[model samples]
Target: MHIPGFDTTTIGVADGIELTTAMGGTGSPVVLLHGFPQTHLMWRHVAPILAERHTVICPDLRGYGASSKPPATGPDTYAKRTMAADITALADVLGLGRFALVGHDRGAHVAFRAGLDFPDRIDRLGILDIVPTLDTWNVLHGVDAAVAFHLYLMAQPPGLPERMIAASADEFFGHFLDIWSASPAAIPPDVRAEYLRACRDAVPSIVADYRATATVDIDHDRADLAAGRRLTMPVTVLQQDWGSALGFDAAAVWRPWAPDLHHSLTRAGHFMAEEAPADTAAAILDLLDR
Candidate 1:
Protein backbone atom coordinates (compact mmCIF):
# COMPACT_ATOMS: atom_id res chain seq x y z
CA MET A 1 0.00 0.00 0.00
CA HIS A 2 1.07 3.57 -0.63
CA ILE A 3 1.95 5.91 2.25
CA PRO A 4 -1.02 8.04 3.28
CA GLY A 5 -1.65 11.05 1.03
CA PHE A 6 1.29 10.23 -1.20
CA ASP A 7 1.02 9.17 -4.85
CA THR A 8 3.32 6.69 -6.59
CA THR A 9 4.72 6.59 -10.12
CA THR A 10 7.07 4.43 -12.17
CA ILE A 11 9.21 6.68 -14.29
CA GLY A 12 11.94 5.51 -16.66
CA VAL A 13 15.28 7.13 -15.85
CA ALA A 14 18.20 7.62 -18.27
CA ASP A 15 19.97 4.29 -17.96
CA GLY A 16 17.15 2.01 -19.16
CA ILE A 17 16.07 1.58 -15.53
CA GLU A 18 12.71 2.63 -14.16
CA LEU A 19 12.16 3.94 -10.60
CA THR A 20 9.07 3.54 -8.47
CA THR A 21 8.83 7.00 -6.88
CA ALA A 22 6.58 8.17 -4.07
CA MET A 23 5.60 11.83 -4.30
CA GLY A 24 3.59 14.17 -2.06
CA GLY A 25 2.75 17.74 -0.94
CA THR A 26 3.46 20.90 -2.87
CA GLY A 27 5.73 23.97 -2.90
CA SER A 28 9.53 23.90 -3.19
CA PRO A 29 10.77 20.46 -4.30
CA VAL A 30 12.72 18.02 -2.17
CA VAL A 31 13.78 14.49 -3.11
CA LEU A 32 14.40 11.90 -0.37
CA LEU A 33 16.33 8.74 -1.28
CA HIS A 34 16.28 5.41 0.58
CA GLY A 35 19.16 3.10 1.50
CA PHE A 36 19.63 -0.67 1.46
CA PRO A 37 17.13 -3.38 2.49
CA GLN A 38 14.44 -0.70 2.60
CA THR A 39 12.24 1.07 0.12
CA HIS A 40 10.93 4.65 -0.05
CA LEU A 41 8.70 3.81 2.93
CA MET A 42 11.68 4.46 5.19
CA TRP A 43 10.82 8.12 4.67
CA ARG A 44 7.13 7.73 5.54
CA HIS A 45 7.50 9.67 8.79
CA VAL A 46 9.83 12.42 7.59
CA ALA A 47 8.48 13.01 4.07
CA PRO A 48 4.94 14.01 5.04
CA ILE A 49 6.18 16.63 7.45
CA LEU A 50 8.62 18.00 4.88
CA ALA A 51 5.85 17.72 2.31
CA GLU A 52 3.87 20.16 4.44
CA ARG A 53 6.09 22.87 3.01
CA HIS A 54 7.78 21.34 0.00
CA THR A 55 7.14 18.89 -2.80
CA VAL A 56 8.66 15.67 -1.45
CA ILE A 57 9.79 13.00 -3.89
CA CYS A 58 10.88 9.62 -2.56
CA PRO A 59 12.13 6.97 -4.99
CA ASP A 60 13.28 3.40 -4.45
CA LEU A 61 16.75 3.83 -5.88
CA ARG A 62 17.59 1.91 -9.10
CA GLY A 63 17.97 -1.63 -7.80
CA TYR A 64 15.85 -1.68 -4.65
CA GLY A 65 12.13 -1.50 -3.92
CA ALA A 66 9.55 -1.60 -6.72
CA SER A 67 11.98 0.01 -9.18
CA SER A 68 13.19 -1.61 -12.37
CA LYS A 69 16.28 -3.82 -12.12
CA PRO A 70 18.23 -4.26 -15.33
CA PRO A 71 21.05 -6.78 -15.66
CA ALA A 72 24.47 -5.65 -14.30
CA THR A 73 25.99 -5.43 -17.82
CA GLY A 74 29.16 -3.75 -16.48
CA PRO A 75 30.57 -2.01 -13.41
CA ASP A 76 29.84 1.48 -14.72
CA THR A 77 26.14 0.72 -15.20
CA TYR A 78 25.41 1.04 -11.48
CA ALA A 79 27.96 3.75 -10.72
CA LYS A 80 26.76 6.63 -8.57
CA ARG A 81 27.21 8.90 -11.60
CA THR A 82 24.57 6.88 -13.42
CA MET A 83 22.43 6.72 -10.29
CA ALA A 84 22.85 10.45 -9.75
CA ALA A 85 21.69 11.07 -13.29
CA ASP A 86 18.57 9.06 -12.50
CA ILE A 87 17.71 11.52 -9.69
CA THR A 88 18.36 14.53 -11.88
CA ALA A 89 16.07 13.18 -14.59
CA LEU A 90 13.44 12.39 -11.99
CA ALA A 91 13.64 15.95 -10.71
CA ASP A 92 13.39 17.27 -14.24
CA VAL A 93 10.27 15.18 -14.83
CA LEU A 94 8.82 16.79 -11.71
CA GLY A 95 9.78 20.21 -13.10
CA LEU A 96 12.27 20.83 -10.33
CA GLY A 97 15.32 22.41 -11.88
CA ARG A 98 16.67 22.94 -8.37
CA PHE A 99 15.61 20.80 -5.43
CA ALA A 100 16.85 19.99 -1.96
CA LEU A 101 18.18 16.41 -1.70
CA VAL A 102 18.32 14.02 1.27
CA GLY A 103 19.64 10.45 1.25
CA HIS A 104 20.53 7.64 3.64
CA ASP A 105 22.91 4.66 3.27
CA ARG A 106 23.35 3.72 -0.40
CA GLY A 107 21.03 6.54 -1.35
CA ALA A 108 23.24 9.00 0.54
CA HIS A 109 26.17 7.92 -1.60
CA VAL A 110 24.10 8.85 -4.64
CA ALA A 111 23.08 12.16 -3.06
CA PHE A 112 26.67 13.15 -2.26
CA ARG A 113 27.66 12.33 -5.82
CA ALA A 114 24.62 14.21 -7.16
CA GLY A 115 25.62 17.27 -5.19
CA LEU A 116 29.17 17.13 -6.52
CA ASP A 117 28.25 16.28 -10.10
CA PHE A 118 25.18 18.46 -10.43
CA PRO A 119 25.92 21.37 -8.12
CA ASP A 120 23.26 23.43 -9.82
CA ARG A 121 20.58 20.72 -9.53
CA ILE A 122 20.78 19.77 -5.87
CA ASP A 123 20.45 23.17 -4.20
CA ARG A 124 20.91 21.80 -0.68
CA LEU A 125 22.05 18.39 0.54
CA GLY A 126 21.48 16.29 3.67
CA ILE A 127 22.92 12.81 4.27
CA LEU A 128 21.67 10.68 7.12
CA ASP A 129 23.42 7.84 8.94
CA ILE A 130 26.39 7.47 6.62
CA VAL A 131 29.74 8.91 5.62
CA PRO A 132 31.31 8.62 2.18
CA THR A 133 31.73 5.01 0.97
CA LEU A 134 35.46 5.27 0.29
CA ASP A 135 36.05 6.94 3.66
CA THR A 136 34.33 4.10 5.49
CA TRP A 137 36.23 1.44 3.54
CA ASN A 138 39.55 3.25 4.02
CA VAL A 139 39.23 3.22 7.82
CA LEU A 140 38.28 -0.46 8.06
CA HIS A 141 40.25 -2.74 10.42
CA GLY A 142 39.96 -5.77 12.66
CA VAL A 143 37.68 -4.03 15.16
CA ASP A 144 35.41 -2.80 12.39
CA ALA A 145 35.37 -6.25 10.84
CA ALA A 146 32.12 -7.47 12.36
CA VAL A 147 30.26 -4.19 11.79
CA ALA A 148 31.22 -4.05 8.12
CA PHE A 149 30.76 -7.64 7.09
CA HIS A 150 27.96 -6.75 4.66
CA LEU A 151 30.27 -4.44 2.70
CA TYR A 152 32.86 -7.19 2.36
CA LEU A 153 30.23 -9.80 1.67
CA MET A 154 28.46 -7.74 -0.98
CA ALA A 155 31.72 -6.50 -2.49
CA GLN A 156 32.82 -9.99 -3.38
CA PRO A 157 32.45 -11.51 -6.87
CA PRO A 158 28.87 -11.60 -8.13
CA GLY A 159 28.22 -15.36 -8.01
CA LEU A 160 28.92 -16.04 -4.33
CA PRO A 161 27.32 -12.92 -2.80
CA GLU A 162 24.21 -13.33 -4.92
CA ARG A 163 23.78 -17.02 -4.16
CA MET A 164 24.51 -16.64 -0.44
CA ILE A 165 22.21 -13.66 0.09
CA ALA A 166 19.47 -15.12 -2.11
CA ALA A 167 19.52 -18.30 -0.07
CA SER A 168 18.48 -16.46 3.10
CA ALA A 169 17.54 -12.94 2.09
CA ASP A 170 15.06 -12.49 4.90
CA GLU A 171 17.38 -13.67 7.61
CA PHE A 172 20.18 -11.59 6.14
CA PHE A 173 18.28 -8.34 5.55
CA GLY A 174 16.17 -8.68 8.69
CA HIS A 175 19.37 -8.89 10.71
CA PHE A 176 20.14 -5.28 9.80
CA LEU A 177 16.71 -4.00 10.85
CA ASP A 178 17.10 -5.83 14.15
CA ILE A 179 20.69 -4.92 14.98
CA TRP A 180 21.06 -1.54 13.31
CA SER A 181 18.01 0.03 14.88
CA ALA A 182 18.14 1.13 18.51
CA SER A 183 14.55 -0.13 18.86
CA PRO A 184 12.65 -2.93 17.17
CA ALA A 185 9.47 -0.89 16.78
CA ALA A 186 11.53 1.67 14.88
CA ILE A 187 10.68 -0.44 11.86
CA PRO A 188 7.15 -1.74 12.28
CA PRO A 189 6.39 -5.39 11.54
CA ASP A 190 4.75 -4.76 8.17
CA VAL A 191 7.55 -2.47 7.01
CA ARG A 192 10.22 -4.93 8.05
CA ALA A 193 8.49 -7.67 6.12
CA GLU A 194 8.23 -5.43 3.08
CA TYR A 195 11.97 -4.75 3.19
CA LEU A 196 12.71 -8.45 3.39
CA ARG A 197 10.43 -9.22 0.49
CA ALA A 198 11.95 -6.56 -1.72
CA CYS A 199 15.49 -7.64 -0.95
CA ARG A 200 14.63 -11.24 -1.69
CA ASP A 201 13.04 -10.34 -4.99
CA ALA A 202 15.91 -8.15 -6.18
CA VAL A 203 19.00 -10.08 -5.18
CA PRO A 204 20.90 -9.94 -8.46
CA SER A 205 20.32 -6.25 -9.21
CA ILE A 206 20.98 -5.41 -5.57
CA VAL A 207 24.24 -7.35 -5.45
CA ALA A 208 25.32 -5.78 -8.71
CA ASP A 209 24.65 -2.33 -7.21
CA TYR A 210 26.82 -3.19 -4.22
CA ARG A 211 29.56 -4.73 -6.36
CA ALA A 212 29.72 -1.55 -8.44
CA THR A 213 30.68 0.28 -5.27
CA ALA A 214 33.77 -1.92 -4.73
CA THR A 215 34.91 -1.25 -8.28
CA VAL A 216 33.61 1.53 -10.55
CA ASP A 217 32.27 3.69 -7.72
CA ILE A 218 35.66 3.69 -6.01
CA ASP A 219 37.39 4.71 -9.20
CA HIS A 220 35.05 7.68 -9.69
CA ASP A 221 35.48 8.83 -6.08
CA ARG A 222 39.27 8.54 -6.30
CA ALA A 223 39.32 10.57 -9.48
CA ASP A 224 37.28 13.30 -7.78
CA LEU A 225 39.65 13.28 -4.80
CA ALA A 226 42.61 13.56 -7.12
CA ALA A 227 41.05 16.64 -8.71
CA GLY A 228 40.34 18.13 -5.24
CA ARG A 229 36.65 18.64 -6.13
CA ARG A 230 34.39 19.64 -3.24
CA LEU A 231 30.67 20.27 -2.92
CA THR A 232 29.85 23.86 -3.79
CA MET A 233 26.60 24.15 -1.82
CA PRO A 234 25.59 23.80 1.83
CA VAL A 235 25.70 20.23 3.18
CA THR A 236 24.40 18.40 6.24
CA VAL A 237 25.47 14.97 7.52
CA LEU A 238 23.78 13.29 10.50
CA GLN A 239 25.13 9.90 11.51
CA GLN A 240 25.26 7.41 14.35
CA ASP A 241 28.55 7.57 16.33
CA TRP A 242 30.40 5.04 14.22
CA GLY A 243 33.49 7.03 15.19
CA SER A 244 33.80 5.19 18.50
CA ALA A 245 32.89 1.93 16.79
CA LEU A 246 35.05 2.48 13.69
CA GLY A 247 37.73 4.82 15.11
CA PHE A 248 37.45 7.96 12.96
CA ASP A 249 35.75 11.32 13.29
CA ALA A 250 32.68 11.17 11.01
CA ALA A 251 32.17 14.93 10.84
CA ALA A 252 35.84 15.68 10.27
CA VAL A 253 35.88 13.10 7.50
CA TRP A 254 32.93 14.81 5.77
CA ARG A 255 34.34 18.37 6.00
CA PRO A 256 36.77 18.11 3.11
CA TRP A 257 34.08 16.99 0.65
CA ALA A 258 31.57 19.53 1.93
CA PRO A 259 33.30 22.72 3.08
CA ASP A 260 30.11 24.45 4.19
CA LEU A 261 29.07 21.47 6.24
CA HIS A 262 26.84 20.82 9.21
CA HIS A 263 27.76 17.43 10.64
CA SER A 264 26.74 15.86 13.93
CA LEU A 265 26.14 12.58 15.76
CA THR A 266 22.72 11.37 16.83
CA ARG A 267 21.36 9.15 19.59
CA ALA A 268 19.41 7.15 17.03
CA GLY A 269 20.77 4.00 15.38
CA HIS A 270 21.79 3.66 11.74
CA PHE A 271 18.16 4.10 10.65
CA MET A 272 18.07 7.58 12.14
CA ALA A 273 15.28 8.86 9.90
CA GLU A 274 12.83 6.34 11.27
CA GLU A 275 14.06 6.02 14.86
CA ALA A 276 14.25 9.80 15.12
CA PRO A 277 11.90 11.19 12.49
CA ALA A 278 11.23 14.49 14.19
CA ASP A 279 14.92 15.10 14.62
CA THR A 280 15.71 13.90 11.10
CA ALA A 281 13.01 16.09 9.56
CA ALA A 282 14.19 19.06 11.57
CA ALA A 283 17.79 18.50 10.46
CA ILE A 284 16.73 18.29 6.81
CA LEU A 285 14.64 21.44 6.97
CA ASP A 286 17.55 23.15 8.66
CA LEU A 287 19.84 22.14 5.78
CA LEU A 288 17.44 23.54 3.17
CA ASP A 289 17.11 26.80 5.05
CA ARG A 290 20.88 27.15 5.29
Candidate 2:
Protein backbone atom coordinates (compact mmCIF):
# COMPACT_ATOMS: atom_id res chain seq x y z
CA MET A 1 0.00 0.00 0.00
CA HIS A 2 2.95 2.28 0.49
CA ILE A 3 3.96 4.47 -2.48
CA PRO A 4 7.75 4.22 -2.46
CA GLY A 5 9.60 7.54 -2.06
CA PHE A 6 6.44 9.63 -1.94
CA ASP A 7 5.73 11.91 1.04
CA THR A 8 2.43 13.34 2.19
CA THR A 9 1.77 16.92 3.31
CA THR A 10 -1.09 19.40 3.41
CA ILE A 11 -0.78 22.85 1.86
CA GLY A 12 -3.16 25.77 1.75
CA VAL A 13 -4.17 26.15 -1.89
CA ALA A 14 -7.25 28.36 -1.95
CA ASP A 15 -9.41 30.55 0.25
CA GLY A 16 -9.73 28.61 3.50
CA ILE A 17 -8.95 25.31 1.76
CA GLU A 18 -5.89 23.12 2.21
CA LEU A 19 -5.02 20.28 -0.20
CA THR A 20 -3.31 17.06 0.80
CA THR A 21 -0.63 15.93 -1.67
CA ALA A 22 1.64 12.91 -2.16
CA MET A 23 4.67 13.90 -4.23
CA GLY A 24 8.05 12.35 -5.11
CA GLY A 25 10.53 11.52 -7.87
CA THR A 26 12.90 14.10 -9.36
CA GLY A 27 12.42 14.70 -13.07
CA SER A 28 9.84 16.53 -15.20
CA PRO A 29 6.79 17.18 -13.05
CA VAL A 30 3.56 15.22 -13.50
CA VAL A 31 0.52 15.99 -11.37
CA LEU A 32 -2.11 13.32 -10.80
CA LEU A 33 -5.52 14.28 -9.47
CA HIS A 34 -8.13 11.89 -8.05
CA GLY A 35 -11.83 11.80 -8.76
CA PHE A 36 -15.15 11.20 -7.00
CA PRO A 37 -15.86 8.39 -4.50
CA GLN A 38 -12.07 8.24 -4.05
CA THR A 39 -9.08 10.15 -2.87
CA HIS A 40 -5.47 10.73 -3.96
CA LEU A 41 -5.05 7.07 -3.02
CA MET A 42 -6.96 6.22 -6.20
CA TRP A 43 -3.57 6.54 -7.91
CA ARG A 44 -1.98 3.97 -5.56
CA HIS A 45 -1.21 1.50 -8.34
CA VAL A 46 -0.08 4.03 -10.96
CA ALA A 47 1.86 6.66 -8.95
CA PRO A 48 4.85 4.57 -7.91
CA ILE A 49 5.80 3.62 -11.48
CA LEU A 50 5.24 7.17 -12.70
CA ALA A 51 7.52 8.21 -9.82
CA GLU A 52 10.30 6.10 -11.32
CA ARG A 53 10.99 8.74 -13.99
CA HIS A 54 8.73 11.67 -13.34
CA THR A 55 8.07 13.74 -10.26
CA VAL A 56 4.59 12.31 -9.83
CA ILE A 57 2.35 14.45 -7.65
CA CYS A 58 -1.04 13.24 -6.50
CA PRO A 59 -3.46 15.38 -4.52
CA ASP A 60 -6.85 14.93 -2.89
CA LEU A 61 -9.04 17.38 -4.70
CA ARG A 62 -10.64 19.73 -2.12
CA GLY A 63 -13.61 18.28 -0.24
CA TYR A 64 -12.27 14.73 -0.60
CA GLY A 65 -9.62 12.78 1.24
CA ALA A 66 -7.62 14.85 3.73
CA SER A 67 -8.20 18.20 2.05
CA SER A 68 -9.88 21.00 4.01
CA LYS A 69 -13.32 21.83 2.60
CA PRO A 70 -14.66 25.17 3.71
CA PRO A 71 -18.25 26.29 3.28
CA ALA A 72 -19.36 26.92 -0.29
CA THR A 73 -20.45 30.56 -0.72
CA GLY A 74 -21.86 30.08 -4.19
CA PRO A 75 -21.48 28.00 -7.35
CA ASP A 76 -18.03 29.53 -7.89
CA THR A 77 -16.67 27.73 -4.81
CA TYR A 78 -16.90 24.32 -6.49
CA ALA A 79 -16.46 25.45 -10.09
CA LYS A 80 -13.55 23.80 -11.91
CA ARG A 81 -12.09 27.25 -12.49
CA THR A 82 -11.87 27.70 -8.74
CA MET A 83 -10.53 24.17 -8.29
CA ALA A 84 -7.99 24.75 -11.10
CA ALA A 85 -6.81 27.89 -9.30
CA ASP A 86 -6.13 25.73 -6.26
CA ILE A 87 -3.90 23.50 -8.42
CA THR A 88 -2.01 26.56 -9.66
CA ALA A 89 -1.40 27.60 -6.09
CA LEU A 90 -0.25 24.11 -5.19
CA ALA A 91 2.24 24.22 -8.08
CA ASP A 92 3.46 27.61 -6.96
CA VAL A 93 4.10 26.25 -3.48
CA LEU A 94 5.85 23.20 -4.92
CA GLY A 95 8.06 25.42 -7.15
CA LEU A 96 6.81 23.87 -10.41
CA GLY A 97 6.63 26.24 -13.38
CA ARG A 98 4.95 24.03 -15.94
CA PHE A 99 3.88 20.38 -15.73
CA ALA A 100 2.04 17.53 -17.37
CA LEU A 101 -1.30 16.73 -15.71
CA VAL A 102 -3.37 13.55 -15.48
CA GLY A 103 -6.86 13.45 -14.01
CA HIS A 104 -9.56 10.79 -13.63
CA ASP A 105 -13.31 11.34 -13.11
CA ARG A 106 -14.06 14.53 -11.15
CA GLY A 107 -10.36 15.30 -11.19
CA ALA A 108 -10.54 15.13 -14.99
CA HIS A 109 -13.30 17.72 -14.70
CA VAL A 110 -10.81 20.04 -13.04
CA ALA A 111 -7.96 19.12 -15.40
CA PHE A 112 -10.02 19.99 -18.47
CA ARG A 113 -10.73 23.40 -17.03
CA ALA A 114 -7.13 23.86 -15.87
CA GLY A 115 -5.87 23.14 -19.37
CA LEU A 116 -8.26 25.74 -20.73
CA ASP A 117 -7.75 28.36 -18.01
CA PHE A 118 -4.01 27.99 -17.38
CA PRO A 119 -2.73 26.90 -20.77
CA ASP A 120 0.75 28.24 -19.97
CA ARG A 121 1.10 26.27 -16.73
CA ILE A 122 -0.38 22.88 -17.69
CA ASP A 123 1.89 21.79 -20.52
CA ARG A 124 0.04 18.65 -21.50
CA LEU A 125 -2.94 16.71 -20.16
CA GLY A 126 -4.24 13.14 -19.89
CA ILE A 127 -7.87 12.57 -19.01
CA LEU A 128 -9.22 9.13 -18.10
CA ASP A 129 -12.89 8.13 -18.37
CA ILE A 130 -14.65 11.43 -18.94
CA VAL A 131 -15.65 13.84 -21.68
CA PRO A 132 -16.45 17.49 -20.99
CA THR A 133 -19.18 18.37 -18.45
CA LEU A 134 -21.21 20.08 -21.17
CA ASP A 135 -20.97 16.98 -23.33
CA THR A 136 -22.29 14.91 -20.41
CA TRP A 137 -25.35 17.08 -19.89
CA ASN A 138 -25.97 17.29 -23.64
CA VAL A 139 -26.02 13.50 -24.08
CA LEU A 140 -28.21 12.41 -21.16
CA HIS A 141 -31.44 10.58 -22.11
CA GLY A 142 -33.41 7.38 -21.34
CA VAL A 143 -31.02 4.60 -20.30
CA ASP A 144 -27.99 6.88 -20.44
CA ALA A 145 -29.80 9.08 -17.94
CA ALA A 146 -30.16 6.03 -15.70
CA VAL A 147 -26.43 5.33 -16.09
CA ALA A 148 -25.66 8.76 -14.62
CA PHE A 149 -28.33 8.91 -11.96
CA HIS A 150 -25.90 10.39 -9.46
CA LEU A 151 -25.30 13.36 -11.75
CA TYR A 152 -28.94 14.36 -11.63
CA LEU A 153 -29.36 13.39 -7.98
CA MET A 154 -26.43 15.45 -6.73
CA ALA A 155 -27.16 18.28 -9.13
CA GLN A 156 -30.51 18.92 -7.53
CA PRO A 157 -31.01 21.84 -5.11
CA PRO A 158 -28.30 21.94 -2.46
CA GLY A 159 -30.32 21.07 0.65
CA LEU A 160 -31.65 17.76 -0.69
CA PRO A 161 -28.33 16.20 -1.76
CA GLU A 162 -26.49 17.37 1.34
CA ARG A 163 -29.14 15.93 3.64
CA MET A 164 -29.65 12.66 1.78
CA ILE A 165 -25.94 11.90 1.41
CA ALA A 166 -25.25 12.83 5.03
CA ALA A 167 -27.98 10.51 6.22
CA SER A 168 -26.32 7.49 4.54
CA ALA A 169 -22.87 8.69 3.61
CA ASP A 170 -20.89 5.45 3.82
CA GLU A 171 -23.52 3.49 1.91
CA PHE A 172 -23.79 6.16 -0.77
CA PHE A 173 -20.03 6.47 -1.27
CA GLY A 174 -19.37 2.73 -1.09
CA HIS A 175 -21.93 2.09 -3.82
CA PHE A 176 -19.68 3.71 -6.44
CA LEU A 177 -16.62 1.83 -5.21
CA ASP A 178 -18.43 -1.47 -5.59
CA ILE A 179 -20.32 -0.84 -8.83
CA TRP A 180 -17.86 1.27 -10.86
CA SER A 181 -14.84 -1.03 -10.75
CA ALA A 182 -14.53 -3.78 -13.35
CA SER A 183 -13.34 -6.19 -10.68
CA PRO A 184 -14.36 -6.01 -7.04
CA ALA A 185 -10.76 -6.51 -5.98
CA ALA A 186 -9.46 -3.46 -7.88
CA ILE A 187 -9.87 -1.33 -4.74
CA PRO A 188 -8.37 -3.09 -1.77
CA PRO A 189 -10.10 -3.11 1.61
CA ASP A 190 -8.13 -0.36 3.36
CA VAL A 191 -8.34 2.03 0.43
CA ARG A 192 -12.08 1.48 0.15
CA ALA A 193 -12.47 2.21 3.88
CA GLU A 194 -10.57 5.47 3.53
CA TYR A 195 -12.80 6.64 0.66
CA LEU A 196 -15.93 5.86 2.67
CA ARG A 197 -14.56 7.67 5.69
CA ALA A 198 -13.70 10.80 3.75
CA CYS A 199 -17.02 10.97 1.92
CA ARG A 200 -18.94 10.41 5.14
CA ASP A 201 -17.39 13.46 6.76
CA ALA A 202 -17.54 15.81 3.77
CA VAL A 203 -20.94 15.26 2.24
CA PRO A 204 -21.89 18.90 1.78
CA SER A 205 -18.67 19.96 0.08
CA ILE A 206 -18.74 16.88 -2.12
CA VAL A 207 -22.31 17.47 -3.27
CA ALA A 208 -21.58 21.18 -3.81
CA ASP A 209 -18.82 20.13 -6.20
CA TYR A 210 -21.38 18.20 -8.25
CA ARG A 211 -23.92 21.00 -8.10
CA ALA A 212 -21.37 23.52 -9.34
CA THR A 213 -20.65 21.29 -12.30
CA ALA A 214 -24.33 21.30 -13.24
CA THR A 215 -24.62 25.05 -12.85
CA VAL A 216 -21.55 27.29 -13.12
CA ASP A 217 -19.33 24.64 -14.68
CA ILE A 218 -21.73 24.05 -17.56
CA ASP A 219 -22.10 27.80 -18.03
CA HIS A 220 -18.31 28.08 -18.29
CA ASP A 221 -18.13 25.26 -20.82
CA ARG A 222 -20.87 26.78 -22.95
CA ALA A 223 -19.16 30.18 -22.82
CA ASP A 224 -15.86 28.61 -23.86
CA LEU A 225 -17.53 26.93 -26.82
CA ALA A 226 -19.08 30.23 -27.83
CA ALA A 227 -15.72 31.97 -27.55
CA GLY A 228 -13.90 29.08 -29.27
CA ARG A 229 -11.36 28.61 -26.46
CA ARG A 230 -10.17 25.08 -27.13
CA LEU A 231 -7.56 23.13 -25.18
CA THR A 232 -4.45 23.86 -27.29
CA MET A 233 -2.05 21.57 -25.41
CA PRO A 234 -1.22 18.00 -26.36
CA VAL A 235 -4.10 15.92 -24.92
CA THR A 236 -4.70 12.23 -24.46
CA VAL A 237 -8.18 10.99 -23.56
CA LEU A 238 -8.43 7.33 -22.45
CA GLN A 239 -11.98 6.31 -21.80
CA GLN A 240 -14.57 3.53 -21.95
CA ASP A 241 -16.72 3.49 -25.12
CA TRP A 242 -19.26 5.85 -23.56
CA GLY A 243 -20.17 6.95 -27.08
CA SER A 244 -22.00 3.67 -27.52
CA ALA A 245 -23.91 4.16 -24.28
CA LEU A 246 -24.65 7.87 -24.76
CA GLY A 247 -25.17 7.70 -28.52
CA PHE A 248 -22.62 10.35 -29.54
CA ASP A 249 -19.31 10.25 -31.37
CA ALA A 250 -16.88 10.72 -28.49
CA ALA A 251 -14.01 11.59 -30.80
CA ALA A 252 -16.14 14.07 -32.68
CA VAL A 253 -17.18 15.53 -29.34
CA TRP A 254 -13.59 15.93 -28.11
CA ARG A 255 -12.11 17.08 -31.43
CA PRO A 256 -13.61 20.56 -31.15
CA TRP A 257 -12.12 20.97 -27.66
CA ALA A 258 -8.71 19.37 -28.14
CA PRO A 259 -7.03 20.60 -31.30
CA ASP A 260 -4.25 18.03 -30.86
CA LEU A 261 -5.82 14.98 -29.23
CA HIS A 262 -4.99 11.30 -28.98
CA HIS A 263 -8.23 9.57 -28.13
CA SER A 264 -8.40 5.88 -27.22
CA LEU A 265 -11.21 3.70 -25.90
CA THR A 266 -9.94 1.95 -22.82
CA ARG A 267 -11.05 -1.60 -22.07
CA ALA A 268 -11.60 -0.93 -18.39
CA GLY A 269 -14.61 0.04 -16.34
CA HIS A 270 -15.42 3.49 -14.92
CA PHE A 271 -12.50 3.24 -12.50
CA MET A 272 -10.04 2.60 -15.32
CA ALA A 273 -6.85 3.82 -13.68
CA GLU A 274 -7.22 1.52 -10.71
CA GLU A 275 -8.68 -1.35 -12.75
CA ALA A 276 -5.92 -1.14 -15.41
CA PRO A 277 -2.95 0.62 -13.84
CA ALA A 278 -0.24 -0.61 -16.18
CA ASP A 279 -2.15 0.46 -19.27
CA THR A 280 -3.15 3.76 -17.65
CA ALA A 281 0.43 4.53 -16.60
CA ALA A 282 1.69 3.80 -20.12
CA ALA A 283 -0.96 6.09 -21.56
CA ILE A 284 0.00 8.82 -19.07
CA LEU A 285 3.69 8.50 -19.95
CA ASP A 286 2.82 8.72 -23.63
CA LEU A 287 0.80 11.85 -22.95
CA LEU A 288 3.66 13.54 -21.12
CA ASP A 289 6.21 12.36 -23.67
CA ARG A 290 4.12 13.79 -26.48
Give the best candidate by lDDT.
Answer: 2
Mind giving the per-residue lDDT tens digits that candidate 1 earns over 7-82?
Answer: 9999987757889999999998989999987999999899999989989999999888999888888897788888
Q: What is the C-alpha lDDT profile of model 2 across 143-183, one tens digit per residue?
A: 66887888989999879888888898888889888888788
What lDDT does candidate 2 reach at residue 3? 57
Off by over 4 Å in 1: none
Note the Cα lDDT for every prediction shown. 0.88, 0.89
The TM-scores, one per candidate, come to 0.98, 0.97
Count of clashing pairs, candidate 2: 0
TM-score of 1: 0.98
